[model samples]
Target: MSALTDNTYRLLRAQVTGATDRIVKLALFETVSEVCRLSLSIDPPTDPLSDFAGWLDDDQWLKNHTLVIAGTLARLYAMPKRPWSDIDTARVNKEQYDTLLSYARADAAEAPNIDPTARLLGSIRSRLPGAKDSQTRLALFDVLQEACQRGRIWTELVPFRLVPGKQVFSIAQPGARIVMLLNAQHSVLGMQALNYSDEKIAVRTDIATLNPADLLYLTMALAPSLGADMENPATWMPGDIFASKYTLLLHGVLGAMMLQTAKPYSNTALGQYHTQIYSRELNAAPLTDRDGGLPTRQRWRFPRFA
Candidate 1:
């Protein structure tokens, strides 16, 4: 049994229209995951086996166990392959999940940072040789923003529950986290077709056919939070999205910096060369869409220049 499987509702498994023990456990796991992934602001947690603390112990988790149950049922009955498919009942469960998830999203900030992703990473700021003036400091922020906007240097996973019949979904986090939706995936279900604009995710499926707690995992190309003070390098951390992909972020920043027209670091030829390297490494990642066609994420690698 996984850490989440508890005797709390063992009897529920044997009742009318009962579910297997495995389905219950998976539902619990996904419920916990939805909250846990918010802090990441980057890639979704890669390993499922890793321990997630506060299991069954947290008050909110216990109180909202229905969110877990409701979400699961919505998935269960909505399946076309299942003999128990019940569209009407599924819609009711989905409505409950949607209302609950809205509350969940509202309180997302209070969710524990299992990996502490919101913490500052000084790696990028550390690259700039102690610039004395505010201008140089802000330049660092500007260039990073530009590089991120120019292409998908790295990707972030953001999961949100689907609201049935909602026409357009916004992934915009303006002034907070700069991100573009490179691709999207549906939990339980697979990759969803994404025709996005202004971070509005438009998928191919009919909304009524989907249920709430039906998670849509948006693979976003992210820029770290820009709300930090430009004058204070200590405050300039790049969020967890860049945690494992520091090289890609650095290359993008450096390339953009060198290409700046009037900056002290401007070196057109060198900038173009570094930019080329940035592009190469960006494409190498197995899951990132650096070129806007098909994103990969083989880990954007960087080579030291001679």
Candidate 2:
């Protein structure tokens, strides 16, 4: 490796390893918070599907995906880990497993390899948003059911597609370099679009200006390894969770890169001041207001693949 590249890799390894303790702690807190948020709404019997349906609108697709993601995350982070959980051992399709495994291998080495799983994931993700795909629909339902039992969130490996046209251009398979799109609000820029054509795999953004809530939300959404209470650790294992962790790290780096691209801000100051201000603003702001900020609370819209 070139001296520059080698130096950079060393730096990243140091950073990730150094923060492993923090990541584990932060992930635990996040998992608990999501559960608490859900608990506040759930009634006796705790029918998560019903609770989910009531909490969300008619957008079943997005609801299914989000619930599945949340559920899977919860399961992964569940305390006192359940080792024999079927959710963790349920056989993944051979082809799909192979594809993701290959991607994972590539990711470890930081190699650029084509990932078939990306195509499948993109297709499902696209369809899940609104397309009437029975498999996608059923899979999400199954995932939700799994979540109810084990608190696991199911995820698929997919390719980063071009926006507008939503065409699959390149896949950030395992080990492939990735870029982050969203700021703290999960407002993703068209990084996939830009990466499709160039060697670059990130976007330009004002991370220094990002609201802290947005960062927290982004952290929740981006960190794949982080989970809520869903199953026992022995059942799923740390290796199983690392993939998600890597993905989240990539997203975090993307956010950091965006800030770097903008006017340089000391990392220390960005974490302290900007994050605090953003957090206060987010906490103070209303999620929604009906009648154009009138007294009535506006209904919350669950975002689908849109």
Candidate 3:
């Protein structure tokens, strides 16, 4: 049952009928995987799913994740020069297929606030060589981490109190991760790390400096939300930073994918298509929510009561 049945091929073909042509099962099979990989690269799943061949035979995957199959059909039927190609009908299928992807992406927004790493990984794999290679995941992780760092603007109000007459005070969280202290007006506080090792810092209060009287809270340029291991698919995505902005990861990879010399996924268009989307999403995103998008302090201050 792990192979596409003749009935399945016929079912897929029914959507793109042609007098002079039919999609061979083998060809369709390959197309199914290509579409699946590309689709996943666009929006990664939090939990790992079956590979393309197994999913083709999986009743649940076919029934629930129909976009993968629909996308394949749309490509073959609409991509031009095929005997069975029909741009008009293919447009309809492609529209429906894209709509499904959109819906799934929207629904994913409601799921647990996980990292976009797993999703980004799938995306990187789809566009480049070494789809599941470890080195590739790490390299792409660096790409994702860089994006996260640049976009690392989130706040948390943890256990911190100004000790009067003291130049230094211990932070509720580590000093190395803290970006800066913020005043109540959300202005960066002129504070310096006295000792990152001790997680202590000093704040300057003067005519030219912001006041700690209404000291806002902690800001972090922390590492992505994920477990220690990069190899684990389960731990691939970090927390909220990516859940909603998962598409940003897609955009990032697409822009980067253009630079790749890899076939099939490569494009001569370079980063034009990808860059706009990446910047738009990254710039358009409001600073991550104070609580949800940032899980670092909570993990540190409130270790599992579980």
lDDT of each: 0.52, 0.29, 0.49
- Segments of candidate 2 deviating more than 4 angstroms: 1-46, 49-55, 59-72, 84-306
Candidate 3's C-alpha runs over 4 A off are 1-120, 123-129, 163-166, 170-176, 180-200, 204-216, 221-238, 262-264, 286-306
Instruction: Please report, as a residue range, the 10-residue window in candidate 3 with the lowest summed lDDT.
Output: 297-306
Compose the digit string of candidate 2's lDDT tens values, residues 1-306: 132223322332342333343433343334323433443232322333232223322322121222223333333333233332334322322222333333333343432242423332333343223333343333323322322122222222233322333222333223222222121223454222222233223334434443333311210011122232233222222233323222322222222322332333224433333233223222322221011212232222113311
Q: Report the candidate with higher TM-score, 2 versus 3.
A: 3
Clashes, model 3: 7
Q: What's the lDDT for candidate 1?
A: 0.52
- By lDDT: ranked, best first: 1, 3, 2
Q: Candidate 3: lDDT of 210?
A: 41
Error of 1 at 258 (Å): 7.2
Root-mean-square deviation of candidate 3: 14.8
Candidate 3, 176-246: lDDT as tens digits: 24433332223554333222333455555432344446543554434434344666634433344444455
Candidate 3 lDDT (Cα, whole model)? 0.49
Instruction: After the best TM-score superposition of candidate 1, give how far the Cα of residue 152 lies from its true spot, in angstroms.
Output: 2.3
